[model samples]
Target chain A: MKKILIGIIVVLLLAGCSGGEQVQSKPQDQGYVFNYNGIPIVVNTDVEPVLKELGEPLDYFEAESCAFQGLDKTYYYSGFELTTYPKDNTDYISSVYFMDDSVSTAEGIYIGSSVDDVLEAYGEDYTGGENAYIYTKGDSSLIIITENDEVISITYQALVEGLN
Target chain B: MKKILINITCIVLAVLFLAFLQKLFMPKYMSSIYEGNLIEEYYDSDKDHDVIFIGDCEVFSNVSPIVLWEKYGITSYIRGSAQQLVWQSYYLFEETLKYEKPDVVVFNVLAMKYNEPQKEAYNRLTLDGMKLSKSKIDAIRASMLEEESLITYLFPILRYHSRWSELTWEDFRYLFNKRKVSHNGYLMRSDTKPVTVVPEGRKLPDYSFGENAWYYLDKMTKLARENGIELMLIKSPSIYPYWYEEWDEQIAQYAKENDLLYVNFLPLADQMNIDYSKDTYDGGLHMNLAGAEKFTAYLGKILKENYNLEDRRGDTKLAAVWQDKVEFYEWMKQDQAMEMEKYGYLKSYGAAAQAIIN
Candidate 1:
């Protein structure tokens, strides 16, 4: 009776020990679901989640995330993939940055009304240090800045006529 | 005393239950089981295998163990892992010593993998395989769960016990329905078009004989030599030849200093009669089934002529098994060709399984 009682107690104790959140599968084991700023979104992969959560990416590539072959596809964030497409087809998200875990914004030019207007929009928070040069390559704005506080000259190049 | 008995009983029951559950739930025959045995079996068989291929996807996608086994009667097996490293090779050989021993061990070094960021957990998991026989409790403890073994064992739902929720109907049926393991074991696609990798001006890092990698290599060499086994370092064909050449120089220097045999096959792809554009399933890093067949056959001839290995085919106990496996391979080959045609290079599960046998 005592042995049986012990067995029952043991089983119950084992059972009691159970029940906790399963260790989230490794990042490469399956698709990912992420909450970006309280918005839940499912990204097909780690890379996708990172890109979606962070914003625009700098550069990325697909790779196996582990030493084993069983891992699902993972993306290597090399920065971001940013391009200014024509105004017709795609919505412009502007310059994007990509990372292994997430993507984020990088400091640079803005697209809209005028150069000084863009500077005022970013305000003093913009780290345009000494010798900072802002220019426009056609419709795209260009800005180059250095370490010490300096505002370099800004230039606006003309947009090519009938450019796609 | 009662409490002690209870703890002991719990551990034993937990272990047995875990074992039973693992057997019941796990895929009946996994690729690891086959790969684990394939190397030992070839080594044990009376027939001398022509070449022993090693490395990761670079080897499996490019070299067919079965083709080598069948064509040249070379009892070859691919001891490659997914993204194999020089360290894992050490453990594999360590484990392999328990059963059969091979004549030659080939090391297919990858170029991009030299500076890989290591994974501590995965390493611990693989290292656990080395400690399975001390006791059942020890075995459970030594598994991939590591510190989580107790929790996972008792609850199971902790790891795969509740895995039912994690899988789909397709996965459930496919896993439960399989009684036999059929596979070619190659996952990556073979490419033919040559790609270039020009490192932005970095001289090859000195891969001298004193580092951890060199220590493992030295140990492996000494182990093989002590066992009267030959060691060959072969570079699998790759699209990026520059990286291969760079590593090849380092490996060759190591070989020259250590008195080991080294062969560079990256630049020999065309010389081996591999059709660049079509024979490759990918653009070039790996080989397709067709490419693997050619490469394995060539490798087999090399082992036979150079190594003076004896092809002990008809007399080995594994002959019957090999014959059946070959028959399965033929079926899989036909199925794969059709599937590839239909799926257009994106192979299905069945095609993937068939690929291993091929």
Candidate 2:
């Protein structure tokens, strides 16, 4: 009877622990990092240091998060756009969207690059969608959207951790 | 025999106690985040409706059932919740069919963009109000995030036990009863925050709807067809979270192939007289009560023309019930207006009140 009671209590404790919200750990060494000028910006990491390093943005916008507290902010640069999601009163990089072909990914893949070029650079080990190919490394994903054999959009996104 | 009887009684009492605790611990969405209460409000309504609108915040905040009734005498209900996924909407529709069948089922296509389970808070907002059933079970299974467990949903006490420390009077007062937060599932916002600039949709990596989203949509279509209901797909005219042309084309193509009526109302905002400067409540994410009335007036006409629906105003019993709804609607509208007048913002509605309090 004592053993059975102890087992039940242990199970309940484990269940309680398992049910807790899972906070995604910040990527340390892995994940794709975009090099803007001399600064390197990584997704799922604190955006403050990167923003300070990158200087003033061309444009900025923020909206109260839908059905959640805090704000979703966007900063537009010359060739790319950086978006951040607020958590614990601090902003974390959510995504980096390439706007023009003037800038390329850290991997040398740019807009107007061929699908073959992407395969050559990033390799064939990617999840292929109808028009987009997603290459994931650790917590970050490099998505290249193609149309007519030419890449139209390239974006690096952090895998959303439950709530943003 | 006596020992067995005592043990049985104790077991029954223990079960009852846990159930009571579950009820008490549940978040009573009386003051804030009223969207959580929208789902259960459907149970109180007279279930005989000509149309059912199901989706996320887009349907609940954009469409007005009161306006539909007043203009065309068309009875309708919107079963919408915050960030409602496609599978959640499908199960909700399946559950709604168990109560009553509407002639037309309108599903907002915005939720199709999301392929996976979103925030757990959003899942709770949509699912907690739903009564325990096979549909709710299926919905919970389909909607649970990576961290969420089935047992937690089954026994809400397990999920909300920690909420004991945070329990307010609202929780205790609404332990057995919930306040009516929506009018036929429409969450009314009388205040306006006009659109300044409609942000362009960021270039998405994939424009194609996920296979999971398509699967549920196909299921929804089949379910509607089996019930002899016309499924109308709509893109509500909220300008933000920008609805892409590519997404629109795919839905349009699917609708064309399936012989369904697909309407993208964004471009027709001018015809609908939806002035973003006045119509939108939160920039461009959702429409205010004024906007919903205008949209509903336009939609009511189309629904009347296309669908085989009778203006149930002639039905004395239904009319009587709707009369009460109209009265309540008017009272709430006036009350909200009064609150706005006094506070310069709604004091009892949404995060505004919490902001003021803080």
Candidate 3:
């Protein structure tokens, strides 16, 4: 009887420990959920939610929208400036001028995020490729244009992969 | 019966433990643990390649190995990792030699910006070469050295190891969402263009007859020659105006001293007719998908005409294995045409970025 009682307690403990293991979320799943221009959107949910998660970018534009824009391919995010190597000089773009600033009714709670979050999470690529940008990985492609600070139009090549 | 049960239990436990250990040490999947496993798996070649491209984001994001194989018929592999520096390149080449013996090595100089290699970089390079061991100490050592390895190669959890208690309804979205089409390899720039302004008369970093940068350049050349491999110093195109005078001067000097092949296509920005105002993905530092197509085409021609590289795509043996690359090249050409028609703007080809210095 005592052994049976001990087994039950052990099972309960194991279950509790597994609770922490189940918290993994893909970019398309949940990190930043929002409704942009009436489209239910989530960033970093499926894979690492790059800025492209805005869904065909509905007339939106950012400079560095390509695959290698910021964190994925730049010195700034490689823990280099802070932990690894210090650059001789560093400059950050204080503000971006997009031709269009019309907010397409950005709704949805961006929980536990800051302006830096938007920058690091999505804005880096947008801001970096401000002049001209190309985003490509494998066959997936998105071309973005920003005039002042507003995104213009983002057109993607529909030749996607692994759609079975 | 009791004795038999005990024996079976012991055997089963042993097998499970071994399997677990194998999964922990030499994981084949991409996750948090093995950061570069994805790259290694995709670019694995049984024999030595003709060319090996190494460096940081530029190498992986800009250059396509599949394109090289299809165009030049040269079996090339671009082994780049996120934020990879020169030191990491040194170790990666050393480790890659164990599997492949390439004749030519192209080292991107931008990675020279990295002063030294880090513990994580060192650990990944080291662990990628090791096989699984049943020893607990070895596993712990690997985990300590490169935590991502623990997630990628050994234990799968480290890759997907997130900090959520339970997934919400949003978790299911990935299942229904459309997966982007996988191409030969390359990311496309968005159409949203940014108006760029280059600072005039910027004091450029000098690449004179000799400098600190040249020291590493010499070291890489020596390393390549000692191994009987030819080295090519390449500078990929970026939108930044500085790439022209300052960056090109240094590359040219290096090429001149070593009699090495140096290709500087920056000044031909107008001649190449690259829509820098549009084709640049990142403020002119790197090319977008459109830019990569123009740039890679020039690179491929250089390899073909100068190096006497033969297109081995038709060779039965080479074709059998690299079949995907051949198909990818065809797809890339098709994709380019599709873009040209879709966008209604095609830039004239630039002077091919090629060199045969020696």
Going through the candidates in order, what is the number of backbone clashes in each?
A: 34, 0, 77
Q: How does residue B256 of candidate 2 score in lDDT?
A: 99
Docking class of 3: incorrect
Flag regions of model 3 displaced more than 4 Å: A1-164, B1-38, B43-48, B117-195, B198-219, B240-248, B328-358
Give lDDT for model 3: 0.44
Best by lDDT: 2
Each candidate's fnat, in order?
0.04, 0.23, 0.04
Worst 10 residues of 3 chain B by lDDT: B349-358
Best by DockQ: 2
| RMSD vs true structure, all candidates | 12.2, 3.4, 15.5
* CAPRI class of candidate 1: incorrect
Better of 1 and 3 by TM-score: 1
Q: Across residues B67-137, which tens digit of lDDT does each residue of candidate 1 receive? A: 76677666765655444456566556655555567777777766224432233223223332233423323
lDDT of 3 by residue, A1-164 (tens): 34554564344334433332322211121222224334333222222133234323222222322111122111111101100111112111111111223322132113223334334434445322333233433332333443444334332222211010
Q: For residues B1-358, could you state the per-residue lDDT of candidate 3 as single tens digits? A: 9987876776676556544433333322221222233244434344546778766556655666666776677777776554454545665666566666777777766655434333333233334434344322242242342123343435423322231333334333422232222232233333323435442222212223234345556767777778887777776666432344655676777678877787766656665567777776555655656666667667877776766766777888877778865575566556656665776533221101111000
Off by over 4 Å in 2: A1-14, A23-30, A53-56, A113-121, A162-164, B351-358
Best by TM-score: 2
